[model samples]
Target: MADNSKARVRRLMPEDAAPYREIRLEALKLSSEAFGSSFEQEGSQPLDYFRETLAKTDVFGAFVEADLVGVAGFRRQAGTKQAHKGYLWGMYVRPVARGTGAGKSLVKAVLDHARERVELVQLAVVSDNEAAQRLYRSCGFVAYGHEVHSLKQGGRYYDELLMAVALTLPST
Candidate 1:
């Protein structure tokens, strides 16, 4: 899809799972080093898993016409101690849509949706991913610290810089 025009950003529905999977798998394929999961890992997951995840999470998609251009989402961290924090993950925008505000919109939507329930939204971006780092920064995310040797994939290791954005409590 051409990226010159503004893309529409909206909350994801159950029907959007296939497109969501397609773009997400594409992202993982193009830059395996930048991702926490590999195509081999997520590709073979049952389609139901994608559908179920899409249905349950606070996810948003950016579409150019009907083509899904980008997506971002959050999942509540599992545990009584950490349940107040939502972890942002699997964010991607097509290369063509990178600077067209798609990423920002997708992320902002997820953050807005999570704000009522979670006080913190956590994420990790590879240290070398400047575009992603800048996008996250613009959304009020701050670095908590860096984790050396945080992930291992494809016979090589990678580090993901930890980040979080605090969500203001909903006004009474």
Candidate 2:
């Protein structure tokens, strides 16, 4: 659905496994350092796995006409002590759609979903990924810490900047 010439971000349905998997595998392959999951690990997963995940998590896809252009995922923490927290993950925008507002729309949709169910939302970005970090900051997420050796690839480690945003104002 187009809204005033803007691509609309919609939550993926179980039948969207094909397009979702296509974009996800592409993201993992094109920007391995930006995601925690490897292309090999996710690529081997069956179509049913994608469908199951779509059913479980609040994953949203940005579509330009009938083609899927971008995707992001959100999940709330489980368990009593941590149930108030949620996370934003797997954020990726197709290179062609980078400057077309798909990335920002995906993030804003995730934050809007998170605000409904959790008090805080968290996400981590590769330490040197300045563009992604800047996007998150513009959405009101602030860095709280940095984790060293967060992910390793080919014997090299990458640091991650941990960030979070409070969905609700502090109680007085």
- Go through the candidates in order and give each one's C-alpha lDDT: 0.84, 0.90
Q: Provide the lowest-lDDT 10-residue window in model 1.
A: 1-10
After superposition, candidate 2 runs with Cα above 4 Å error: 1-5, 169-172
**Best model number under TM-score:** 2
Q: Which ten residues in a row have the lowest lDDT in candidate 2?
A: 1-10
> What is the TM-score of candidate 2?
0.93
Q: Write the per-residue lDDT of candidate 2 for residues 51-162, one digit (tens) a residue.
A: 9999988999998999899999999999999999999999998998876778888988998887778899999999999989988887889999999999999898999999
lDDT of 1 at 62: 88
Per-residue C-alpha lDDT of model 1 across residues 1-172, encoded as one tens digit per residue: 2224377888888777788788878988997887777899899987777888788887788888988998887788999999889988888889988788888888887888889888999999998788899889988999998988787875777788899999887888
Candidate 2 residue pairs in clash (backbone atoms < 3 Å): none
Identify the leading candidate in terms of lDDT. 2
TM-score of each model, in listed order = 0.90, 0.93
Regions of candidate 1 where Cα sits further than 4 Å from its true position: 1-5
